[model samples]
Target: MFRALAVAFAVVLIAGATTFLALRPIEQVHSSTPVAAAPLRATTTRPTSPPTTTAPPTTRTTTTTTTTVTANPVSVVENFYAAINERDFATAWALGGRNLGRSYTEFVAGFDGTVRDDLTVTSVTGQTVYVSLIAWQTDGTPRYYSGWYTVSNGEIQHGKLSG
Candidate 1:
């Protein structure tokens, strides 16, 4: 009876120890704070040049005088009309800037059957020159017209026609 009771107590103690181990929470021996890893080194054999330094710019004061020479607006308009009256379309077109926005053929066609009879400069304001003119059509009918021409860089840039 004594040996049986001793064997039974030993079995109960072993079972109790196994149950406590299985239910207990596991613990770590190290700290929870993260450890910083060492920086990795690069292996390269490329040659590097030393940094360069530049001198500061010097400060100076100098006076500059500019001169501009422009052709007379009245003369430019007169020359352009003279070319048109002579049926010299190429010269007329050349006298105008790229802003004319018309082809040589179109320019000639627009002036077809038109002859400039007379012209007079009415006024000159800065780059704009105004002129009054009388023209004859193909049927010999007379037409009166007034125009304001804008000249720039020694070339006729644009024009507005009115009656």
Candidate 2:
């Protein structure tokens, strides 16, 4: 009976060991070095005519550049007033008549003895700007004036004045 029990225990231990060895997981090791591939050679259908080579066709490219100029309404009015303040009659006159129909002499005579003390742009409607200003005559009389000035092409085309 003791020999039979010992044989049975030995058989069970051997079976468990066999099962554990068979079910154990396997680990794979990867190499860190890069492997180079072999270069490919082109094959030709015909070995005759010394393998003639043809050049590709040439292409023509055309480029066009365009420029646009736009005038600012406020700058025109400000520059006109600046020319007037500086007593540059010729420049002031040139800055006029895009919309205003006054002649050069008339424009110059209008600014005579009229010193612009202060100017305030009240509002702007399209190309027209309404302004209120304080001016003085040659006799030193202070006057309040308001007017609408129309500008085009950096010039004063027309103006309406009231005091």
- What local distance difference test score does each model get? 0.76, 0.71
Q: After superposition, how far is residue 70 of candidate 2 from its true place, in Å?
A: 2.1
The estimated TM-scores of all candidates read 0.54, 0.55
Can you write out model 2's per-residue Cα lDDT over 14-96, one digit (the tens) per residue? 76766666566644456797556445333323222332443457898999989665467777777777878888767767777
For candidate 1, lDDT tens digit of each residue in 1-163? 5555555556666767667766666554576996664454433232233224334589999999998989888888888888888888788888883357777777778787796657789999999999898888889888899988899888899987777
| Residue runs of model 2 more than 4 Å from their true location after superposition | 1-62, 97-99
At residue 57, candidate 1 shows an lDDT of 80
Best by lDDT: 1
The TM-score of predicted model 2 comes to: 0.55
What is the alpha-carbon lDDT for the whole of candidate 1? Answer: 0.76
Error of 2 at 49 (Å): 35
